[model samples]
Target: MFVKICSKSELPEGGVFRFDPETAEKAIVVCNEGGEYYAIGDKCSHGNWSLAEGLLENCHLECVLHGSSFNLKTGWPDKRPATKPVKVFTVKVEGDDILVDIESGVLLEKPDA
Candidate 1:
């Protein structure tokens, strides 16, 4: 199932928006690169830093703490210091509301292109 995160207007081009659910166990970071949207795990795999607070360059999101860059599409570490891949969430835009599916209880696999 998808949860409403925020409005589409709130996320601009090359912008990052952190979405928190009712529980503190999970958080999602959504990125607006151009007109498309991509959602990924908010926390960095290698550090305690939030990826949403990091720099966004194209599809790569750089963690300021360790300077690790993760691909928004696949959640793979494109740079050093991060060998493990983060979770990539599915995003859906419904009119003005932006929804995200955590894909919880699902098996880890290659992201869809």
Candidate 2:
């Protein structure tokens, strides 16, 4: 099933919302870059820092903690100190609402934290 994380208006034109599910500390970030919206795991592979607090550009997410950049579309770490990828979710836009499917793992996932 898909989870209704947030509405389109709740996010800024180029901002991200850090989501931490109550059921599990498994967090993710819902990003809105202009009209393109995406969801990715909040955790950074390099460290415990969350990607939601980073900057977004060209569909890439930059980790502020260590300057590691990740492709927001694929969650693939593009820069150093982070060779692994983070989890990515399937995002859908429906009538100003953004939906996320955590099961797809389009962003990837770590089996053992």
Candidate 3:
């Protein structure tokens, strides 16, 4: 099922929002890149750092601790220090609401451990 995380107005262009659902095990990071919405796992694949605390340039989110940049569209890390990709979730904008399908999260690469 899709959950309403925030309104479109709340997240301006090139903005990021972190949502932690009480029912979920991991938090989600919602990003607005040039008016497009993308959702991915909040934690950095290489470290326990929060992706929301990192920088967003183009469609990639860079981890502040290790400088590992992950593509928001595919969840694959483009920079080094990170081998595994983070989970990506389906995002949909309905009217003024931004919804995320937490149940449909997919990890592009499996973790080694």
Candidate 4:
């Protein structure tokens, strides 16, 4: 099921938001990249650091602990030290609200276009 994380205005372009649900196993990091919204696992695959605390540039979230960069769209590590990709989630924007599907479980790979 889709849960409302925040409003679209609450997260500006290039901004990152972190959400940890009591019923979920992993936290989620929601990003706003030039109006588009993307969600991924908050933990870095390499260092287990929070992706929300990382820098967001060109849709890539860099891990502050080790500089591992993960693409928000695909959850693939663009930079090294991280060979594995993080989990990605389905995001949908409804009116001024931003919603994410964390109940469906994690997505190891990017969904087919």
Candidate 5:
């Protein structure tokens, strides 16, 4: 099921927005760039750090704690210290609401911490 995250206005282009919808298993980091939105596991696989706190350069989200980087689109890590991939959710825009469906097309459960 899809859950409303937030208004599209709250998510600006070229930035990241963290949302915790009622249906979410945990907080999710939503990336907004060029009128597109992407959702992925919020917590980092390597250090348990919040991925929203990391920097978003293009499709890569860099972990601030250990300099690990993950590709937002595929949840693939581009550097050392993070071997496991994260769970990615599908994002859809319905009117003014940004909806995320974790159960629709999400990746398998994240690796153990």
Candidate 6:
């Protein structure tokens, strides 16, 4: 089931809302751009830094620890230092609420060799 992460008003345009759920140790962030909302893991795959402290432009999330970049849509790292991809959660906007399905679980998987 989806959980209400934050409200549409809480996240400013081109800004991010970092969510630390009371039940989960994992950190997630909701990014808003031009009224579009995207969710991704807050930890950087490179050095495990907080992506919430990193730079965000358009749909690109740059790691604060390293210069690695990830696609907000796919969570795939676009640079070095971060070979693994971060998790991207599904977000839905209903009226004034922004909900996320943390239970549905969005994780990175290894490719079959």
Task: Report lDDT (CA) for all predictions.
Answer: 0.81, 0.80, 0.89, 0.86, 0.79, 0.79
RMSD of each: 2.8, 4.5, 3.6, 2.8, 4.4, 3.0
By TM-score, who's the top model here? 3
**Total colliding residue pairs, candidate 3:** 0
How far is 67's C-alpha from truth in model 6 (Å)? 1.1
Estimate, for each residue in 1-113, the C-alpha lDDT of model 3 and write its tens digit. 89999999989998999999862348999999998999999988887888899889989999999899989988999878997899999999999999999888898764333
Tell me the TM-score of each prediction against the true structure: 0.87, 0.86, 0.91, 0.89, 0.84, 0.85
**Model 1 residue 34 CA deviation in Å:** 1.3
Better candidate by lDDT, 3 or 5: 3
lDDT of 2 by residue, 1-113 (tens): 58888887798788888877763237888898777888888888889888887898888888999998887777888878998988888888888777888776654543342
Q: Write the per-residue lDDT of candidate 5 for residues 1-113, one digit (tens) a residue.
A: 79887888888886888776543447788888667898888887787688888878878888899888877778878787988877788999999988998665455544444
Better TM-score candidate (1, 6)? 1
Query: Which regions of candidate 6 deviate over 4 angstroms?
Result: 22-25, 108-113
Point out where model 3 deviates above 4 Å.
23-25, 109-113
Give the better candidate number (2 or 5) by lDDT. 2
Q: What is the lDDT of candidate 1?
A: 0.81
Assess candidate 6 and give its lDDT. Answer: 0.79
Per-residue alpha-carbon lDDT of model 4 for 1-113, expressed as tens digits?
89999998889999999999872348998999998899998888887578889889988999998888998877888768997888889999999999999865465664454
Q: Which one wins by TM-score: 3 or 6?
A: 3
